[model samples]
Target: MIGVSGTLVRGGTSKCWLFDITDVHGRGASLEDVLLAAFGSQDHSQIDGVGGATSTTSKAAIISHSYESGVDIDYTFAQVGVGVNEVEWGSNCGNCGTAVGLYAVQSGLVRPRGEQTTVRMRNTNTGSRIDAVVDTPGGRFTPSGNATIPGVASPGVAVGLEFLDPVGSTTDALLPSGAAVDDFTLSEGAAHATLVDAGAPAALFDAEALGLTGAETVAEFGAALPSLLGLRHRAGVHMGLAAPGGPVSHAVPKFGVVGAPRDYTATDGTRIAAADYDISVRMASMHAPHPAIGLTSTVAVAAAATVQGSTVHAHAKARDGEIRLGTPAGVVSARLVLDGERLTGVRLNRSARVIARADIFVPRAERVPVALP
Candidate 1:
């Protein structure tokens, strides 16, 4: 039996399984099926896999040594849906960036240093350079921390990942289609819509168009699937995404609502004062509410919030550059580059860690088919 190992670690608000692809001989389609059978499904129980039910947990990482300059590791991200057999290799998830550095240090891929170790990562999926810094004390990899993040249960070590040239990681162009924004008139009698693809392609619509407060809670929006689906369909067309023949299936260009920052209770029951945030935004993954926030979408939202002609909040004396956000969990900052009327880039900060390191048992089916010698 071929042995393949994986490590389960928390990066920002999301978790994933990190693997060493170079060590594994057969990690292509056969191995992908094995991973699905092991962790892809939506029963909430996940039964016999490692998935944690939420989109944040249905992820995997394949790490390898890179030949690129200023980069030591190449990280490829995969998003596996629960109860589904397909694995999406679309874009990069910023939450998993922290794990890259920690994993590199633990595996002796990078020399461990005191206090902090900086590792350069080349995101294979997005072709971006992520500068990851991990906490290493006494020349040992130590990740224990007391710093609290909003969505996580307890405090853990902090690893910061900064993505350089974060725009157009997926589609090659910052706007993907060379358009600052695309407007699709809804097929159903809704209203005009604008789709933006700065960080992640997303569709923007007025909260009033859907009888939303623009200040509604996460649960409130999640419960309105039919309406959300309708919007998602319209957004898919505008963003030039493959229509799943229905609504959006792969959670691209996240759907968000922007409003003037006002005093309101968050999902955690914390009172969010208007002065705390420049603008308030909420996004979705498929039809479910994100537990706390998503790093990629956060970048997109912050970028859109600063734009002058989007459905985002219009009265905050919009900033001329990058914007900082206060979410239910804590503060998340992203950089927004505006060239003329086009959004150039939306860079985000994230962290990753290495929880476990060892070899895993690979099933026969997961191994390459053998031709008898």
Candidate 2:
């Protein structure tokens, strides 16, 4: 058996296996094979592995002490396919990024400074730098707090995440297609969409254009997966996020449907009044409705909302400041800083905690050849 030491962390709305770079044995295909074994890929239920069998839970974060000046740690996010043996590293997970600072301090990868510690992280996937501030009392990490975030039942330590210069993460420009609004051609008709790249690339569409109310339950969204995926692929091609006629399975340029806020009941049976939020959004993860909105997508949504003529902009009530977005799980808000038409930065709060520390074992037959560092 091959043993790897790691920690299971719940960051924001996603759970991930966090590993040190030295503990990982391989690279490229070999690395993917190891991850597949560890996460029990090619199985719908992930019954044989540590994975939770869901897109949000089947994630991995590889970290290393950064050699770059001013950066505390380097993080790489991986999306492990639940029913397939594939690991996509095309995009960074803002939820996972929220926990990197705590991981660094806990594992001694970086020393904490005073009562509050700030760790500068460089996301290897997109080469974006994020400043994560975690509360440390007497140079020790603190995991207790009353701050709460949607999708998480209990409150934990509040981690402040600032996505600095968060534009064009995956593409060449903020608007990769050079248009705030573009025509996304579908089989039945065409719809107006906005392809924005802030922390991550995303394709946003007005819910009405797609015959959606933007307040769909997870099951209801799953029922429409085929058509939604088709629209995502078409938007990917139009935004140059995917090559013409190519597969859109890399998971970059996520797809989301947006609508003006309205009174509706959430999946949790909680009433969400229209006046409580600025807009309503529904995003997809691994072809399924995301229980909660993604942190990176939140930045993309805020950026798009600030841009005039974009799909999100039409539904958004205000041009800037705190934008509260209602999702299937609950409400999430982000503070947007815009300089004219340019998005300067985005700030948000997330809670993270170390759930467990254990060794992840891979069977001898499942182990791949270890690459020399």
Candidate 3:
């Protein structure tokens, strides 16, 4: 058996298995095999591994102390397929981004400079930089605080993150099609969608256009997965996210719908007032409605809201300052700094906690090699 030591951290609404880069062996096909074994990717339930059998829980973060001047750490986010036997490294995870600083400080990868330490992180996946600030009283990372985000049960240390130059993280353009709103015809019907690449590539549509009220429960949305995915696959081709006439199963560019804010019940059965938010958004990860808001999607939503003719912009009110977006879990806000026609940066705060630390043992049989091009 091969043992890999790592920590499991709950960052924002997702959990990730964090590993130091130097400790992980192999590359390319070999690395993929190792990860599949570590997470038990061939099984739907992931019962043989640490994965929680869901997209949110089947994530990994590979971190290394940065040698680049001005950057403190380099992070590469990986989306490990549950039963598909694939590992996609195309985009970064904003939820896991919040935990990078905590792991760095606690693991001595970075030393706190003052009461609060700001770690400049370089996302190797997208070549984007994010400034993550964590509260470090007396030069130590603190995980206890009053910071609370939707989906998370309790308060934890506040991690302020600013995604700098968030545009075009995955694709070559912010508006991949050179238009804010594009029309696509699917088997269901015609739909208007916005393809934005802020922090991550995402396709956004008006819920009404998709025959959704934007307040559907998780189960209701799951029942509509076929239609939703059909729209997503077409949008993916339109935005060059996927090859034309090819099968689409990759996690991104993400798919979501936006609507005018309305009163709705959260996943935890708590009522959310529409008056508190500017718009409502429901996003899908791996073809299912996300239990909570995704950090990268929040950035894309903020960017879409600022652009004219987009669905989010049409329903958005009180444009300046923070934009509160109501999701199935609750509301998550993003503050956008606009410079005329360009978006300068996006800022938001999330909480994270170290859940467990242990050695993941991979059997020799699971590490068998596969042919690669």
Winning model by lDDT? 3
lDDT of 2 at 233: 86
On lDDT, the stronger of 1 and 3 is 3
Clashing residue pairs, backbone N/CA/C < 3 A, model 3: none
lDDT of 3 at 217: 81
Question: Candidate order by TM-score, highest to lowest?
Answer: 3, 2, 1
Task: Give stretches of model 1 more than 4 Å off.
Answer: 1-3, 27-29, 40-44, 137-140, 176-194, 243-249, 313-322, 326-331, 335-353, 358-373
What are the lDDT scores of the predictions, listed in order?
0.65, 0.84, 0.85
lDDT of 2 by residue, 1-373 (tens): 6787889888898888998988876633366777788888868888878899998999999999889999989999999888887899988898899877778778887788987789899999999889888878787877676668887888877888989889887776889889999987677787888999998889988888788877777777667667777778878887787788998755777888899988878877898899999888999887788888889999999888877789888888883488998898888989987777677889998888888998988654434668999
Task: List candidate 2 stretches off by more than 4 Å.
Answer: 26-29, 187-189, 365-373
Candidate 3 lDDT tens digits, 1-373: 7888889988888889999986676633366677888898889999888888999999999999889999999999999989868898877898889888778877888888888888899999889899888878887877577788889888877888899999987776889999989998766678898899898889998889888877778877778767678778888888887799987656678888889989999999999998989988888888778887788889999988878889889887866767999988888889987787789899998888888888988755535667998
In the order shown, the candidates' Cα RMSDs to the true structure are: 4.9, 4.1, 3.6
34: Cα error in model 2, Å:
1.6
Please give each candidate's TM-score.
Answer: 0.83, 0.94, 0.94
Name model 3 segments beyond 4 Å from true.
26-29, 187-189, 366-373
Candidate 1 TM-score versus the reference? 0.83
Return whichever of 1 and 2 wins on TM-score.
2
